[model samples]
Target: MPSKRVRYPFQVLALCLSAWGLAWAGPPAEKDKAPDAASIRRGKYLATIGVCEACHTPPAVPAVPGGGDPDRERLFRMDPDWVRYLDPQRQLAGGVPFILRLSGTTHGLVVTPNLTPDVETGLGSWTEDEIVEVLRTARRKDGRVLFTFPPHSFYNHMALEDARSLARYLKSLPPIRNPIQPRTLPFEPQPMVADGPARAPQGRTRERATYLMGALVGCRECHSHHENGTLVEFAGGSPSDPFQGSFRLGPDLPLRQLEKGFAAFPYPGFAVLYGSNLTVLGHGGALERVPTERIVRAIRQGIDVREDEYGRPRPIAHVMMWQFYKDMADVDALALADYLKTLTPVANPVGVRLKLFGTDWEAAFQQTYGEPPTPEDRAAFGMP
Candidate 1:
């Protein structure tokens, strides 16, 4: 004998609203709001400087009628056509595979995902907060951790505003219907915390440069020395003292030994490349010897024009990500160069085995340096 429950009129109204998928949550959070025009523009600028398109956009085939495969290569590449351009239709619709290698071992390939706003295939369902979280933590909501390819480590503590703007820009893109496969890791990705609090850059030029190189552009990922595994926080470094250089692909031998000479690298024909010392500490450091104009040229042109022992400019190895920086604005590139002159010096002499230009690199190199290397020049660099 239970009294019949009496529902209030308000409760009935609430039930009706819930049934209609219109439950009142007061108001949508700021993160859920549609971005304004200024916000979208700022986001686009940030994405361009971050070179998101370099890794996210698939390449276009010049000869193909309709077009070629979308996911053929990762990063920018020189096709048989010798001209490289991102497919406008598939912009940021990532489907390329980035091979993950350690020392000489191949772990697996990490496929880039569609960043467009496609409801089913891309990030359309993701909230701005979710996108910001991935930028700040390198860990997605699904628990998958991104390593290296995205350089999320450097982006982990970027200014909150900049990160949010970047997210807004990504969400504003036209929805592309590319579906990306999930990545399988050879080892578990460890959870990461920022080395320090997330601090916004001050108005000073060096501070802005710090935020630009360390966070947005990720110059430190390759230039700084790392301890533990490749996924750990950079060791013995701070924002102002990045660029200490690493031995991962460097010649570990002393200067004299390197001069006395060593055999060709273990990987026959492959260049032994390393992040060169950009600080003003060692004999090989760029700050002391290289002019700021030269640094700007290197950043914009990809050729280290600092004459080698052979009295010729060296074409930086492809791994340097110079292609991404080629389009950087002059003011920012100059700021980065000027800032490098003020770094706390760290003595790390790097031995970079320059790569010989191949037929594939012919047109691209010509476009950059005005012409391809002469036959004698190729033989001088040990290319057959």
Candidate 2:
């Protein structure tokens, strides 16, 4: 027999490597389970991270019990008591409107749709698999491609089980009869990606990120500015790429402003609000230079990101949806960061910090919100 060190250690090392290799070998394909309580629970969690309520929820509704099924008659009557609950049981019944913009020009206005099981106004007519297919393709029940939903991309990349969970949860909701206004599209609906919805290859470093961030997490949607229905820029690329001017920041932005972590995003209700330029060419230096722990906080909490010259904390823009993403798995967030690092840089420098609000971002956030998350408060939020 070989020496003990050579025999035992090498054998163990080989075994460990084999196990590690299989981790990224891609998920074993399988059929999904039937919808159940457990699925609803999982879907509820994923939907929260997906920020379903952010777009789907209307501005306000009365807080009341979700008594009786909110069927067609209840919706028609518009009963206050039938509508409200803490978990937004009245949610996904879509009536929220969003202002679509590209380079300060009005693209169109679209309304959120009711996702309830209402026979007339909601998904009651749809089959579960149909919903999943629509989600995966960005094509609606009628084959129309949904253009503006950033989370749609994220949802499309979810595993079958997770995607099913979300669908099951939506079906579990009380189907209220809220007929939402349809989207006003400039072009006919089509698949989001060039080659259509293809799953990532079995094993590759960027495969998951390419699938998730490109379409799933909606990173590409926020970071790149497109022209004539094509993505022409990537926000995280090097500064010298030819596609620099293709961002939504418009071609008029100054380079210096980008250095200060400013970029423009024309929000639905607000004027063009600025966001961070997430490129290696120039960054807030918060994500690039900070420790991994702080980076996680920035992505999860959105606080302690910016600082005044005195190193005091400043506020980040709410446009990026850090609140909804706070629940993202630490692993996923890290994977996103790592994949982002591998992207080719674009020279698109973007900024107009707080132009829409006519106030400092920090002051606005401070006035409206409480403190950033602390590790001590983890238990309350379910962290270990």
Candidate 3:
């Protein structure tokens, strides 16, 4: 037995050593690693701050099946809805069908485009770099740069990490394959006032103005009104009926109404109340018709261009006019004006009459005046 064991091993040992050497070599260096779960969650939170859902998620009705029922656990789960309304063939397609009364007559319901990851119709093909570039530069595929993109600018003040997280969250969304039509503006193209040499700022001034107007000041939020009378995120214009000069300011109308009343009756006289157009032109298409110098004067001095029977400059009754904006310097106002010039014109055909003196107004006035009228003792009160 000892003699046999000694003879069998020499060649076998060399073979075993060669096999072990091959086993030690590992996989190639080019393989990718999976994304971390933690990162995905962070991205989701960032997306909320960026308010992506406000645009992507279709508005739901109170009792409707897919309407946004606040009580529902999956309130903004857009995937299933996208598949329902959007064309199945289109990648990641989804839209909200909404009837926007631009004015009383000029109205139509259009779908707000879906932003999903379907390769054919969604953003499945877009790179992270492209998303970042679009937000930063406001350039579309055709090389036209837009000044604003709604709630995205709300996150303009967000940290870089937050922005990246939002981008990642957007990527994680299921791609819907619906191609959206380009948003149309009502007016003809005009050169941006900011681009002109007269009022253009240089170096730091330009950069500072851009940052303030785009992010901090949020001038666009009030300036842009949507077709449906909604404030279009960073888009300019108040949701004003261009013809009627009235729109909802959510629940803040009392303060404005009081201010208007005070301005109208500075000495207890009825004053005509007018709402600002918020367009580059002052209200009543004056900005479009008047010269820049005149526009500046109206904004600074609260002068109304339209005259009464006497042809005197109508006492500027719009109390809120230039008053709030007056605090801003000439340069700042001009910068704001420059920013306003780029707004996409939405045709807000004047809607129905907005009763400024409604029950609420009467109630407020009564509170200030005191005592309800009494019907008793008509003769005693000199009735006949």
Residue by residue across 1-384, what tens digits does model 3's lDDT show?
Answer: 011000000000000001111111122221133443444465553333222433344333222433444443132222212112212233224443322223222222233445566676555766554554454444434455433323333333533333343445567766655565454322222112121121112222455456544433334443334456454433232223221232221111111101112111111222123244446353343245555555455555556545658977754433222433344445544554554444444444333212243324323222222232133212111122
lDDT of 2: 0.45
- Between 2 and 3, whose lDDT is larger? 2
Candidate 1: tens digits of C-alpha lDDT, residues 21-77: 112122224655656556566567667667676567754532232244544421122
Q: Model 3: runs farther than 4 Å from truth? A: 1-33, 60-94, 97-111, 141-149, 153-157, 186-384
Q: Which of the two, 1 or 3, has more lDDT?
A: 1
Q: How does candidate 1 score on lDDT?
A: 0.51
**Per-prediction TM-score to the true structure, in the order listed:** 0.62, 0.58, 0.34
lDDT of each: 0.51, 0.45, 0.35
Worst 10 residues of 1 by lDDT: 8-17
CA error at residue 344 for candidate 1, angstroms: 5.4
Candidate 1 local lDDT, residue 196: 29
